[model samples]
Target: MAEVLRLHGVRKRYGGGASPVVEVLHGIDLTLAAGAFAALVGPSGSGKSTLLNLMGLLEAPSDGEIWLAGEPVHAAPDAARTALRNRYLGFVFQFHHLLPAFSAEENVLMPVLAGRGRLSADDRRRARALLERTGLAAHAHKRPVQLSGGQQQRVAIVRALMNRPRLVLADEPTGNLDTHTAQEVFALLRELNREEGTAFLIVTHDPGLAARCDGQIHLQDGRLIEPDGAGVVTAAATAPLTAQ
Candidate 1:
């Protein structure tokens, strides 16, 4: 399978001038193949968020390379990085972050509208189709305030897919839902991954959720710890880092 995302020798650090530079991520190396579903699991302060930020193009790495869809984007200019992020990446966070005033369909259309400044008939059709796929067709006209938490999250997921991105980065996507609702949402994500062939890198704290993924990438104090023959490369061999 072609690689959807790759990171080599990636490192991140904070504090430069006055305070001591704190290296959060050490020479990390990882690769996610096309259509793969994986979990990024680690304890608090393990640099999971920092690494995800770099991969999502929200931040730059202090060292090394990030190749998304074969483009070396780590050193790209801000405009280029923004363009690449829109073209190749989608994001879902713990919160739905939907506009309270917009209807479900309109919320799903937000990505296209933001990118193009206007929506076409085709965009509208796609949004409706996604809503239908996720069983939200009836709620298309409902505002976020009118919908339940799970419904709002479903709308957010649909919005992420509006651009048909090659990869989706989900940080604690099901973190706020009840156990049953969380399972349903996760099943929806997995079904979409299989049907759409979009790769997923999900950051989750739920052990069961992580175990359900095709593979898991464990991080500790800012380093990757992988099992042998796990099919992922790391900077160095280390003791297994269990999910918290």
Candidate 2:
């Protein structure tokens, strides 16, 4: 697979001044190839969410370089970064974060709406296809409050994929679901990842769910660790694994 993302010497710190500082990410380096599905598993305060945010461009890194697609991202202008994120990245949070007033179909079309105004006929068709893929076609007219937890999250997944992003960042997407529902959601995500060749970087706490991903990454106090390959280990991972 082609390399889709690369992070080198990445670092992030909070606070400045004489107190100047505590660092979370410490000169971390990582990469993701096209069509890869990986999980970020760590205990609370391990910095998984922070790392995911940095990858998603939701927050800028304090230092280091982030390459997306083939372009270096760390120094890109805000508009450029936003455009790139719109075109190539998708995000699913623990909360669906759907608009309360929009129907499921409308919610699914939000990213397109934000970037391109009204949905084209093709866009609508794609939205429907995604809804169907997530088993939410029947709920397209339903609002978030009208659907069950699983169904709402399914909509969120469909929304994330509406733009056909090459990379997806998910933070605790299944945190709110029951075990059975969470498994179902994970299965759906895996199917979509295989079918669409979309790379996923999910931050999850469930070991069982993390074990199902193609690769697993673990963090401790914001530093990346590969102890026993316990983190970022992959059932299908064939590349020489290294930690930096």
Candidate 3:
């Protein structure tokens, strides 16, 4: 598989030394291969969100290297970073964040339209197909307010895929859903992973969801503990270090 994302010695620090700077990440190294379906699990404040932010180009790392889709990008300028993220990285947060004013199909095309400033005939067809794939073709014309929580989230997933990103970073994508709904969403992500061969790095607190992933990276106190030969992240080592 291709290497979609890689991080080397990435670190983040807030405030200056004179202001009692607080270090959030400690030069962590990580990677995600193509078609990978992995979970990031840790307690709150473990720097999970910070890590995701850095990887998604939402925040700049204080130091180290980042490569996405085989290109070195940690030092890229803001505009370049934004372009790269829009072209190669997708994000889904805990909240669906769907625009209530837009219909399901329009929301699904948000990324595409946002990137190109307009949609093509092929883009529309692709959006419709994605909705159909997620069993939302019938709801394509409905607004988000008219859809259930799960359906709206499913639309968000389709929107993320509209750009055909090499990687999708999901921070608690299922955290807001009920147990059954969470499971369904998880299963859907897995299916898309297989079908599209797009890599996914999901941050999840649910033990069952983490276990269901192909692999899980555990973090504690802004450090990524190397898994042992058995590939288990011990409870002590898996606890989150910070909520910030």
Candidate 4:
């Protein structure tokens, strides 16, 4: 399968100038295959957020290469990176982050508007289609305040899919939901992944949810650890990742 995302010897550091530099991620390497569903699991303060930021192109790696859709992007210009991010990535957080003032449909269209300055007829059509797919068609015109928590999250998920992103980065996507609702939302994500062929890298703390993924990436102290007896990547002394 083609790789949707790849990282090689990626590192991140902070606290320079006057303070000692702290390296958060240590020469990490990872790859997500197209249409694959994977969970990123680690304890708190394990650099999961930093790794996600690098993968999403929200921040550049302190060292090493990052490839998105086969393009090496770690050294790309800010404008170029921004364009690539809008073109190839989508993000969902624990909080829906929906604008309270906007209706569900409008929230879904936010990405398009932000990227293109205005929405076209096709954009509106796609938004409606995604809303329907997530069973939120009837709630499309309702504001976030009018929807239940699950409903609001469903809307957020639809918003993430508006651009048909190649990969979706979900950070604790169901963390705020009740157990039953979290399961339902997770099911929706799996259904969408299968139906749309979009790869997913979900940052989650739930062991059950992590185990359900095609693969689990474990992080300890900013390094990738291979799960015992699993056929996943062993980060130690690995070669630089190449597109496949």
RMSD of each: 4.1, 4.6, 4.3, 4.1
Among all windows of ten consecutive residues in candidate 4, which has the lowest summed lDDT? 228-237
Model 4's number of clashes is 0
- Residue 146 of model 3 has an lDDT of 98
Report the lDDT tens digits of candidate 1 across residue range 8-114: 88888899898987888888888888888889999999999999999999999988899999999999989999889988999999999999988999889888877
Tell me how candidate 3 scores on lDDT. Answer: 0.86
Report every candidate's CA lDDT. Answer: 0.88, 0.83, 0.86, 0.88
Clashing pairs in 2: 216-232, 217-232
Name the 10 consecutive residues with the lowest summed lDDT in model 2: 232-241
lDDT digits (tens) for residues 59-150 of candidate 4: 99988899999999999989999999999999999999999999999999999988999999999999999899889999999999999999
How many angstroms is residue 222 displaced in model 3 relative to the true structure, after the best TM-score fit?
A: 0.4
Which residue pairs clash within candidate 4?
none
lDDT digits (tens) for residues 48-106 of candidate 2: 77788888887888888888998888888889889999999999999889899999999
Worst 10 residues of 3 by lDDT: 229-238
Q: In candidate 3, which residue pairs get closer than 3 Å at backbone N, Cα or C atoms, i.e. clash?
A: 43-240, 45-241, 45-242, 45-243, 46-241, 46-242
